[model samples]
Target: MTEVPLIAPLWTVQDVSEYLRVPVQTLYSWRSSGTGPPARRVGKYLRYRPDDVLRWLESLDDGAA
Candidate 1:
């Protein structure tokens, strides 16, 4: 789905996990450990920027780095 917001696109944890094919728990772990993309808090919920997610993904090597 296309991002609707005008600002940096916000993504749900599930979205990022699914896009990256990683388990949701991994995302939670990264978030709790502050090792992942910066997340925004809104009414106690966490949201990640789509662009940041993409950038973080590009940083992954998968044995290619």
Candidate 2:
């Protein structure tokens, strides 16, 4: 039998901050500098895809090598 896959949940700024253990202000600064994970606008707020964040983090590891 085949099973259905589940969708990943979108993350909020606060959720990202907690996940990464970085301060919320730093995220804002990164956004201004275009150095943070890619996010999309939902109305007036920003939303992040977990996959994008994970890929971004992986890219950082790649740069360090």
lDDT against true structure, model 2: 0.92
**Which structure among the candidates has the greatest TM-score?**
2
- Candidate No. with top lDDT: 2
TM for every model, in the order presented, reads 0.72, 0.82
The segments of candidate 2 whose C-alpha lies over 4 angstroms from its true place after superposition are 1-5, 62-65
- The candidate 2 region of ten consecutive residues with least summed lDDT is 56-65
Error of 2 at 63 (Å): 8.2
lDDT of 2 by residue, 1-65 (tens): 99989999899999999998999999999999999999899999999999999888887855544
Worst 10 residues of 1 by lDDT: 56-65
Q: Report how far off residue 42 is in candidate 2 (Å).
A: 0.4
Q: What is the C-alpha RMSD of each candidate to the true structure, in Å?
A: 5.2, 3.1
Model 1 per-residue lDDT tens digits across residues 1-65: 89877685688888888888989899889889988777788888788889888888788776954
